[model samples]
Target: MQNDAFMHVRKMFPDLSSHRHRDMKVSVATEIKWVVFYRATITTRDGNYQHTIGQRKTLSFKDAKIINLQYCMGVCTRQLPCQNSGYTDPRECSECRCPEGYGGTFCENMAESTIPDCGGELNATSTYQTLQMEGDFQAPSGSSCAWRITVSLEGGYRSFYRTLLGRSM
Candidate 1:
């Protein structure tokens, strides 16, 4: 309800700045006011899309609740890394703006790994209790060979695989 509330809102939405006047009252509600103000500013553009949360004048207490105060208040001034290579406009919220290619609450998966070359081999070695390796495929014998790459952990009990297509002669 103090300056901290407004600070929390600003922390959540870095792209938005309070457009309120200098003499405006500050309280817990003030954060909602600024959210409404900036939510209008950014979304009302000629071609900008309105956010679902911005469609209403007043949100239910649950909707307006500051769900993650710890995270928001703790890193108000920090530019946190996006989970999955999401784009973060410096002027916008500290949260990552995930691209279409990435899909997750935090945009964790952004790019697909490039398949290894036909003749390339990926080998991983470890001196620990078990061994681990990840890379491209090894050299091929002929034009008509299919390669299946498997990745195993230290004990070799957990394994995942991908099938690589064969090259045409």
Candidate 2:
């Protein structure tokens, strides 16, 4: 039986490399009645292809005449997860290759960003003004948080300071 299966495979793909070829699964489809289905997995430079051959009548592996055969091709044959939006068509692996701006096993992750000077300072002042800054801030140690506004005196006098308590600043 092994020799017969090997002969069939050799006859189908005479040049199939031993290192590249994976395995052959030969099974009898009893529910189909009198039909034997065998699948051969062959690896190539692009991907893997499953060649399924269905033989009829004789139970002997050597005498079973090939009645139906089909080839299912591509990387998706391995059945990997490919629900992500950024993934393109299958290339040479189980999962489709990601585009330029996408990544991950299924290309579900967006690529890192590259922006210049994302943060800068914007300051304004008037003759008489109320300074207001409001946002979420992380503190180093102080139990109480305060907003401080300092004003320099007209001459060499000391500076004027005011503190507003609570979360707002």
Candidate 3:
């Protein structure tokens, strides 16, 4: 990961010495599934002069996918509301950076799923509730369902539990 970090930085500053990473500070900002977000700060020296540079980038080693590598390196100045566990996407200021199961321009809707009639919003209450789903599990490669569960009770806590039972055909 450190090597990939230097390679990414070198893309912007080709003249930067590879050895300069000794003065670099790389930290994990967030991790979601297979994606890992990183924030790197480096201190550079030119004779008696010194300078510092920082960038926020993401890397997915399993598939070699890097998010926000070409954009959103700096702070976003746009004011946009992102809903349902979503934040402003640096790559596209007008869109929200949604979590794994959410999507939309502002993350106000459930993500599209391959399975028909499988995604929507649900409301939970104090009583026990159940959500059951049955689909063809043999070829479930790209099938998915996203549901947003919300509770309106104030000053109360909620707990959720899920169980999956599958058998080979």
Give the top-scoring candidate (TM-score). 3
TM-score of 3: 0.39
Error of model 1, residue 83, in angstroms: 3.3
How close is each model in CA RMSD to the real structure?
24.7, 33.9, 17.6
Candidate 3: count of backbone clashes, pairs at least 3 residues apart or interchain = 0
lDDT of all predictions: 0.31, 0.28, 0.39
Q: State the lDDT of candidate 2 residue by residue for 102-162, as single tens digits.
A: 3467755443322221111112223433323233332222222221122232552221111
- Higher-TM-score candidate among 1 and 3? 3
Model 1 over residues 33-63: C-alpha lDDT tens digits?
3443354445434332332234357642222
| Candidate 1: residue 24 lDDT (0-100) | 24
- State each candidate's clash count: 10, 1, 0
Question: Given candidate 1, what's the lDDT at residue 131?
Answer: 19
| Tens digit per residue, CA lDDT, model 3, 61-133 | 2112123423443557874686654666665777777554456888665566654654465555445555444
Which candidate, 1 or 2, has the higher TM-score?
A: 2
